[model samples]
Target: MEYSMLADIDTGEQSSQFLTFIMADEEYGVEILDVQEIRGWEPCTEIPNMPQYVKGGINLRGTIVPIVDLRQKFGFNNIKYITTTVVIVVKVLVEDKSKTMGLVVDAVSDVHTIAHSDINLPPQLGLDTGPRVIRGLVSIRDKMVVLLSSSLLLDLNQFQNIEQINEHKTQQPMATND
Candidate 1:
């Protein structure tokens, strides 16, 4: 379903709405404004020589949206894509350009309005996964939600490479084995 039309009417000065989802039993959230749509699990056209976390790309309308498996991206084992599996289509900004991609998650949770004060900055632990992807940590209904920075989640350098490869593939004709 298209979540693009969902308006952010939260007038609170220091609050924002986030669309939460589950992956490996952990709850994660992204700003609702960045969401384009929510889709059910669907097979995609697998691309060759891409990272393991990059599941592949799917044709959404006229655009070929790349899909990233969050579980694999987060160093988790591959699980079956059940009925609850969903793809959250999000728009991210990179170098002044807007890119659309889908994130494969276990299941979508809920949208919660979080006040600025409620979000706690993630600790500066000696870990690769830092503020680059995780924006902050918030608690909702006693559950901790890792707020994510969608733009940073898809690394700019890596994403540009994917786009370049996609463009090159489209411009070149397929080779025949005859």
Candidate 2:
């Protein structure tokens, strides 16, 4: 999903856990259960014909995990990477299957526990964040947090594209140890 930069930590559901992060000077949260690991930024191999927000793919041990720049995806202005830059590796579920991907963020905020009743309904906006992208809003420490609908963050097409790229990479013939 193109992140709702104004968002905060939660599952977009009642009493859910979230891993909060910062992007484009805003806060966003994803389901903690979906998070695999958090790592610092590293250059990834660029893939041709992909969206600008898709920075590229990284070889995580053996899996080719696609890295998405939340800033660009959210249409944030040009930003320079700094020590706080990080990649939040998350296990995304697409069509009953799980795929690993990385979300690049300016920095990571803290995890927050959201009670079911505390979440406020989302306001109407014509943003690119599809209807299901944002779950709700809540106040924390007198700050508003935006909860994201983890399931709807990305559509099938993006995952399909990543899969195709990975398949293409694997199809390349290997050199013999002659």
Among these predictions, the greatest lDDT belongs to 1
User: Model 2, 114-144: lDDT tens per residue?
Assistant: 7767888888776665537777888888877
Residue range with the least summed lDDT across 10 consecutive positions in model 1 = 3-12
Model 1, 1-178: lDDT tens digits are: 5443333365534677899999999999999999999999999988677788889899888567889999998899899999999999999988888999999999999998787778999888787754378889998989889998898766765677678766876888879999
- Can you give the lDDT of residue 34 in candidate 2? 81
> What is the lDDT for 66 in model 2?
85
Pairs with backbone N, CA or C atoms under 3 Å apart (clashes), candidate 2: 1-153, 7-146, 8-146
Candidate 1: residue pairs that collide = none
Give the best candidate by TM-score: 1
* Model 1 lDDT on a 0 to 1 scale: 0.86
